[model samples]
Target: MTANANRLEVAGHSVLLTFGPGLETVAEEIDALWYHLRAADDDGATPQIRLDYALPSGDLPAGAVPLPARPEASYTISGHLTREVIRRLIGTRLLLHAGAVAHPELGILVLVGASGAGKSTASSMLGRGGAYLTDELTIITPGTFALTPYPKPVSKHDPELGAKRDLALGGLGLRPAHEAAAPAPAMVLLLERIRDEDEPEEGSSVTRVPLSEALTRIVPQTSSLWALPGGLATLAELLNSVGGALEVRYREAAELEELLRRLPPAEHAETAEIEPRPGDVVTWEDTAPAPGRIAAVPFRQALAMESGLFLLGEHGAIHLPGLAGLVWDLLADAGPLTFDQLEQLVVEEIGEHPESTALVRGTVSDLVAHGWARRG
Candidate 1:
């Protein structure tokens, strides 16, 4: 919106950064933010997110700032804006926090782990074999999990590389997978780096993992699983077709190179075609439950346990625990019940109270209003 601004298009979303007069001192960081998207046009109406950054008269935000200061300031402000833009584009795609690499023919291998688990480091070591998909964010379409490369600069950390250097793709001898030839992900590895004392006495190893465990470990890698329409269902189908996943435990980054080379190429499964459903349809209200039984929506099914319920639907997989899980289980199992029936169920389980009836009815009303449950 301002005259002094820079704009870029990312994942079909436009971002505009408006700079204050004195803030130009950190132009390098600002420019780096738009590394891949810089060539994009800056049409005024095209911007979906607009950010304003300023620098006071005291000092510039360049090298004048503390060692980690410049990286923090620029990375935080610009990175936040970019991450927000991508999160909003989750309707048709998925974002996993991982480092991905192609294996010439084994398709894509996504390395997932918690923060400081050595994803970036492992990717750099494995870069020599094939294309470097990403060292941070892995963007892909559902069902197939065919990785669409999001090749932002790699954030590298190693004793020899100096402290926190953001290296280019070539610096690590890696290149992004070409879109025309991008490969569907063959397998996903849940990475865990071990300390000297914790390293496996037999050395590093890779073992086959079950579908349920793979899904569990991968959930934390997803930043917008709940936002991706039908995301939970899509992931289940994708993992099943991958022949499940492998859990890799390692004591060194380079040790993975040989193991990655020996892994077999995955058999690409046909992407399941699920007819799209209306995610926002509503047929219930806050009024008291009617005489008819309530049922989980056809497109929405939930798995419940003692602690919580895992629902897979157009909305997403939601974990409802305690009261939420209790009510969900009642409605989910008993079909649909009248207000009186639901009230009795809640009281029988958690003990009776003066407001128990009202609370249970209110909970049912909310679930109906939210498209989670409906009268049969």
Candidate 2:
């Protein structure tokens, strides 16, 4: 490695970052932002990725990747580095677009949500009292549920520049990963930031989200979840071990610490086996199916809950609620059924309704539209 090169140990992968001459200022900023990931000594760990940043007009190395010549080049480089590392971790870890913080006795509690859902804020706040694992992405080993700490610098929105600035944890008065104790997988919290207009009088509270609904909410927050081997089945197992998922709807990040601490540790339970099946390709388009068209569900896996069931397809998992669940069960065993036949079955199940025709037709169409059911 050259003097301008720095090695980052990110998510168990070694990344070597090299910069061309005349980019010293940007290189210094990158070094400071990723100071937590700096390797102590090169242990000869083969570099998984080597990032070469240079001005577009500057002389380039044989296979060096160039960084955009802009004020926000560091931010862009940070995002690119994260994506490349996550790409390499596709099938190995169950990567959630979340933040993680330790709970002293309860181990690690992951804040699972999409971007702008306040994961970084919650992690920054909650981690003040405990260890901070990460504030962007949470990496967990499937089955065993072990966490790989990737406490990358927290990105703070800079109003002056109208862009985010990656600030070191020490600067923010939060404990860095190196200073923290080892993390153990424990709980999963789905964050739902309640807007003031949505009736703040109701107040903030934490409630248990249904396992089926939780899966639906969580599936979208994952990074390339389908690439993972067990997919939904593995995720279902992890959720069960964590005593399902809890939804925390709060107006402020400060309220979470005391409220979450009051909650008891989840009693891990044995999860039900999710059956994986061979899936069939189904094209999704606006074209509605004919009334006589036969619809069949070719599922990758199926997880049944008390209220609903989750059908995992090649693309993503679809939550089948009430009649939809029954219809999937019917199609899974009864084989292919025409659209008209399905409506009749739904009518028979509910003892007929004026809107049964539209309801059943819409349900089947949705199934096919989401690639959950194939039209034959």
Candidate 3:
């Protein structure tokens, strides 16, 4: 490979970056973080996210995010690249901004929270004897919602406390976590805090939340849920499979590792199979038999994920999945369309299946009933 080009693969996506000739420091730092998982040697498959990093060159490449001249700028550029890739893949994959570790027998455990909420700290500490899936982004496969591990370099900011350098999985006395060919999450924990200075003697606490509430809380934690096809419905399915969530408010990040041991054993239901396709719509045939004209309800934001859709505004939030997502996209474009327009488009996209029109009609009725959409 030439000095100008580098490749890193994560979560079934490949990122290839071609840098300007003089940018050796930038390339080295980014590569140190991901080169172990490089696709440079893999059979030549097209990359999903390809970027050209130029150093204030006369003209920028067609789709490249321009790089900074400062050597330290490399770190920021790498982060931006990761975010862009995650955003691009949101519709195809269920990507969450979270952390994960695998158990000897129970399978994968997930940690989720807002940035600076100690997700990385907890994930790094939990990696000592467990598999480190990721400390930043966790990607869930469509339909089955199986989590595919993508362990990125762990960032250590508190050098006075520990290793200040950003290091790969093995750098912290842990091996890279093997990606789950068929992941079945054992547990999902939301990392909360009781106090900043709570000591181990103070002890930690775990609280259980209803699946509905857990689903609501987790939706916002996702990196790009707005871009997902049926995002909300997809998340709801995932939470239902897990039963619910356990809120872990602890004194130290290390406490999470032990919490895993004390928690109840993984249940067969936790890994039970779920609907595994993004565009698959729930059957609404009986709920609202009559179809109506469909229109987009203006909102602060509205989007469709792989299997769900949502709209938010000062008034409130309303989300849907199954056929609702398909309906939302159809109306979102040009205000409202007739039933014929929806059926025609649906048929064109998914084929002239008998249930397509009925599904769209049922979905529209639900939207109208909820006042999230209008029908005429």
Candidate 4:
């Protein structure tokens, strides 16, 4: 550690930021953003990650990672630090690009969406009343539903500065996670912003969504899905425990207060493994297959939801929605069945169709081509 070193506790990991010569200004900017997490310099324990900014000799310091060169070195270092932390913890936790706030009684409500979807804005505004867990990344411990806060400064794009500025949470008058009540995973909300200039009277609303539809949208927002073993199954179980996911359509963050406050506490159901029932029917109205034996690719694993299924194959995780999901469940459960037998099962589930012959053939062909199933 050097005289210019500043240590920060980031998501339970210790990171030491050692400033290089002529980087005093960059250090100040970083200090402003993470001052809350700064560790006392007297501690002598080595940090898990030690990064150096703008080394004058253009070479990295011994045992330290050199940050990428950028005009805004402060921002570059912040991004690098966040990525490094995520890289180390990817397989151990489920990381979503969502914002989180904790209610005293209702527990934690996670606001999930893609970038520019106003999750950060919503979290920031809601945090004024609830405990702020995070505004950028929401880290969930699988099965337990415990949250690990990565409360980095909220980055807002500044038109005058021509770059995004990281604003400290304290400066905005919001409560940080440590200062708030202990919270547990309670609800997951899919944020959809409805912008209609002509419909000025429109207000925000929250509605319950089916498991399959929520899985389709929420899976892509996760950064650790591919790395975590049985990730889809874990997520499916979590959704079930919290009484499935909800969709919240809103025009602005300010309008959500009354709606959120009036919402009932999440119903905690018995933890159940996500598997298809014997008599489950998929009414997605898609056709089935004919003739030869069909079996799923070897070593493939899958988890079924209400109307969708996730297949983890040699390629990656695949979302089989609607009719496609039904077909997958059949193959995974009782594969190597004759196409006629498969067709019989499909008929039993959704009844036989006049055009099922060709359509089933097409669906089977697609599965074989995509490495999900093969002719036996």
Q: Which has the greatest lDDT?
A: 2
lDDT by residue (57-151, candidate 4, tens digit) is 54656765554434456666767877888888898888887888875555688999877678878888877766777877788887677888777
Q: Model 3, range 1-376, lDDT digits (tens) per residue?
A: 1337778776667778777756777777777777566775856887888777776666765565567756445556657666876877766887787888776654677888876578878888776776777887888876887777777777656556442345666677666675544476767888886574555455577766654446557877776664566665566567656756778878678677667666643222122212223443222221322355566565444434443655543344565666676666666654467888877876776677767767877877887787666665
What does candidate 4 score on TM? 0.79
Q: Superposing every Cα of model 4 onto the true structure, what RMSD results? A: 6.0
The candidate maximizing TM-score is: 2
Error of 4 at 315 (Å): 5.6
The clash numbers for all candidates, in the given order, read 3, 0, 15, 1
RMSD of 3: 10.8
TM-score for model 2? Answer: 0.85
lDDT of 1 at 247: 72
Which is the winner by TM-score between candidate 2 and candidate 3? 2
lDDT tens digits, residue span 45-70, model 2: 77888787776654666666776556
After TM-score superposition, the amount by which residue 305's alpha carbon in candidate 3 deviates from its true location, in angstroms, is 21
lDDT, candidate 3, equals 0.66
Q: What is each predicted model's overall lDDT from 0 to 1? A: 0.63, 0.75, 0.66, 0.71
Off by over 4 Å in 1: 1-9, 30-36, 40-45, 56-69, 157-165, 177-181, 200-202, 264-331, 335-376
Where does candidate 1 clash, by residue pair? Answer: 293-336, 294-335, 294-336
Model 4 bad stretches (over 4 Å): 1-3, 55-72, 104-106, 179-181, 197-202, 264-301, 312-318, 333-352, 365-376
**Model 4 CA lDDT for position 261:** 55
